[model samples]
Target: MRREFKLPDVGEGLTEAEIVRWLVKPGDQVKVKQNVVEIETAKSIVELPIPWDGVVAALMADEGQTVDVGLPIIAVDTAEPGVPAGGAAGTAVGTAAGAAPGEAIKALADDMVPRPPAEGAVEPGAHGSPAPKEERQAVLVGYGVKTGATKRRPRKAPAPPAAAPAAPAIPAAPVANPSRVEVTAHPVPARVAVLAKPPVRKLAKDLGVDLAAVTGTGPEGSITREDVRAAAEIVAQPEPRPARVAAPAGAEERVPVKGVRRMTAQAMVGSAFTAPHVTEFLQVDVTETMNAVARLRAMPDFADVKVSPLLLVARAVVTAARRHPMINSSWDEEAQEIVVKHYVNLGIAAATPRGLVVPNVKNAHELSLPELARSLGELAETARAGRTQPAEMAGGTITITNVGVFGVDAGTPILNPGEAAILAFGQVRDMPWVVGGELAVRKVTTLALSFDHRIVDGELGSLFLRDVGAMLEDPLRMLAWS
Candidate 1:
């Protein structure tokens, strides 16, 4: 019996995904829970596993194709005809092989199709509300029974292929239709098959490295961006050719804004326009916090952990939010109310090659000093690795963007969408400061707080910012304030 597998909704509010690669092609045998495809959504890459054991029949989607959720992407032949449809083997097959061929096929599809979750099924959202039909139905395949609509969902217009390096525009050839001239240029270059992750691929492309020529140095002989850059330095530079003509100035290059970049653009535009932003800046002496960070690093509890000033800043923000709950809140325009969160989902804005992604530590207000340090370490590692899950990026109440990592002093940052406030941490530098009414060299850093005017007034925002700054200045105030 043949069964079709629809593209599953792997994340909340995911509408479509770009098919990155196919692990199994037509004519391959597949096992239960075997990964069949690698897909890129707006946020991250996911490996989707097929739930049933079968012989691959057809690949419904092509690599690089953007497919809508709930659309069939592959068909499989279960091909077991001797067993009863309702028996254990039949259940595993998703339909009875004993039934007539046509009947079995239809029955298998009917039983295998993803369906809306029935009552009492766990939904896939932060609030535990029932997810959309697409999300709920995806879970049906995890179990033996199937539950979605048999018909494939309508697909959007096919996405154009990724943009490539452009050749210089040439003069058009004369055509029969005098109004229309056909311009001919260089043929499109073939894409090289490389085993690097999406972020590494983006890095290599930005560095203008040919992945096929670069040697792999990562685990399992995978190509790393470092290797690509090293290869580019050795081979990418070319001597000037007398016959080569340089392209004209101001010739625009096309870049496809998809995946993380696309999503980030949309989000930033929405947040900038929707929120009435008010930014406040504060400069504080963080020498005490730096000393505390060094102390923690030498401690037995933190000996194995990576400790940084960002952890101290994060903990300070959480402590300040606890004192001023309004800072950790969202504007519920639909409900026409200001929602204050008692707990903090502290978002740390991380910049990646793909774009800016903010993955938060859940219940950060509840974590101990060492636990927060560990969480911050893990969060940064996962984010840089491009393995941050959708759930980790969701439900952030407040955020901290450490622009200091990039040697930036301070900048007014846009608030993360749905959140009321975002704090930007500037680089710590040695500057002359007034301590005990005497000017002395001290470690100083600036903090810029941007908040939604509707949620946080001038006085409340100032108080919150001051509290965080005070904690960093003294480090002991973090404990007192907590």
Candidate 2:
């Protein structure tokens, strides 16, 4: 028997996904719950696992192809090794021996054709007693199965392939360039295959690095991300050029908008226009907070985790939000009401290769300082690797964008959709200030708070900003407020 596997809705009400890569190919045997393909949805990259044990008969879709939620993407043959597809009773050899040429070929093809599994029998070993059809299947990370009809965007026709160049004749003498000599003296090296993992290959493709030209340093001569980055750096160097140069045709490259970048663009545009933004700025002397971070880093509790100024800033935000509940809230236009949240899902904006993603720590106000630091570190690492789940980015009550990491001072930030406020932390610098009528050098930083004017008035916004600044100015204030 042959079974066709349709793409399930991998949560977040997504209609379609792009096939990033296929882990298995035709003729490869795959077991139940084994990941067979990696797909990129609007939110993040997800791996889809096969639900049955079978040999891969065919891949219905190509890598990089956009497939709808209910479309079949792969076919698997579930019959025993010696038995013909469809069953022994409808064996292709038996039917061919007695039927006409056309009829025999049609019979064999029919036997090999894939059929969708019965309703409620999507999982392996579930045919005996089918589960409820509406029940969710845990096939993809952070998502469940949702069956629905979706329209697939028409794919553009591929451009015609360019003609291959003629092979170069081998040189009889040694070449001047050592790299060219190896190519001319020996042809075997040229034919050597480029070895790299799927993720490494994806990195090389994104960086526009030619893997054939890169020398791999990994075990067994496989390329690594560091190698790709090094090659990209070398390729990025500028060469000497004439002062005046003629413009060339088609100098620009067009990148298709999709995935995380597409979703981020849409969300940002909606937030900027829908929310009436009011920004407030404050300068604070954070010398005490800086010293506290250093002391925390040396303490046993924080020895294993990273301690930075951002940690204290995050703590201050959470503490201030508690003091002023209205600051951590949202505007409900439909209900014409203000919704103030009791718990804080503190969002930390992180810039990743894909784009800007804010994965917050759930219930941050309830966590200890050390726990918050650990969560923040893990969140950063996960975002950098492009593994943050959609759930982690949802339900954020307030956000903090640390522009300081980029060596930026400060700027008015747009509020995250559904959230009432966002805080921007700037780079800290040493500045001369007057304390007790005496001028002294102090560690100073700027904070920009942008809030929904409709939800928080000017006075309330100012008070919230003042409280956060005070907490940072004196770390002891956080304890008193708590």
Candidate 3:
């Protein structure tokens, strides 16, 4: 018995993923929980395994196709048919996440027919011209499409054989007699004939437009959409953007959407739309934090780790979140509940080719300052190196994005979806400050915190921001408060 597998929604809010590659093709034997393909999600590459052991029967979807979650990509011939049809196999096949979605995503497959050696190049798949129906295989099972109306789909046709193709043209009867009297027979097309290629002719026929009667603007006086849509119901399509680099005359190029690039695009779009975000900014005098960082560099325990302004800011945000637990939660719309987390899985936002991924350090509150600095270094390295895995990027409780590394002061930021708040840390620079009634240099930085308005109210938001700022302004406050 063959069971088709559709792409599953691997995460809570994902709608789609790009299939990067197929590890197994038709006729290969696979085992349950053995990888069949790798799918690239927005943040990481995940390998999808076969749900049951069987011979690989069919693969639907071509490589590089972007499919909506729950669409099938492959079919597994699970043992024998009398076994009650994989009765225990259920829907668990669609929900597991373990491998990176890789190179080419699965899409509709193309089957081949026996061809003579003299024929030219064959097209890749089903999207190509139609061949004889009998040459095709049994319908593919894993794609999300239901088994209905596939007969309506047209396959591109092979060109007619040259030896027996040409037909005699039928001549139209004369429209005017020799006496100059109008003797109508079959009406002649308008004096200016609409000259168009076969595709344009097909378009005109489908739209119920007469090529003979419409005005032509195309070269060779061909009629177009403005000539068609203006004449009928046909709408012109916008041309796609040109490729960045021109392809070599006949070389095929494959784009791999796996790894960091895919992951980043997914996170940005999720962060942008789901949460109703409101970002508030506060500039702080962080002269004390700078001194503390310098003092920490002098310490024996902290000597190895690279210290930056973000190190102190991370500690401050975590300290402040502890003081304000409401800022560390998700707004559950369906349940109508506000979830407050008792533990902190602090997400540090890292920008990579995969976009903005906040792979958090789990149980950050459990780590000491030197430990936190080490975790931050490892997190940055893992992120920059494009090796952060699926589990690390998932389940972030609260997030902090350091836009300061880019040299910008501050701006509004959106909250990562599900999390109640996200903080943006800006660059610390020397600025004028009043100290003991005298103008002096101070280490200054800006803080921007965006929260889900539905979860963190204005008072709570202000207090969270104020405490984080207070801690940064006086690093000693973190020790005192802890």
Q: Each candidate: what lDDT?
A: 0.79, 0.80, 0.71
Which pairs of residues collide in candidate 2?
A: none
lDDT per residue for candidate 1 within 207-282, as digits (tens), equals 7887777778864466766798777777656654467566687775768788877888989998999999999999
What would the TM-scores of all predictions be? 0.67, 0.67, 0.56
Off by over 4 Å in 1: 80-252
Worst 10 contiguous positions by lDDT, candidate 2: 129-138
Name the regions of candidate 2 deviating beyond 4 angstroms. Answer: 79-250
The 10-residue segment of model 1 with minimum total lDDT is: 121-130
Q: Decide which is better by TM-score, 1 or 3.
A: 1
Q: Could you tell me the lDDT of residue 386 within candidate 2?
A: 89
| Residue range 423-458, candidate 2, lDDT tens digits | 999999999988889999999999999999999999
Best by lDDT: 2
| Candidate 3 off by > 4 Å | 1-38, 47-275
Clashes of each: 6, 0, 42
The full ranking of all candidates by lDDT, starting with the best, is 2, 1, 3
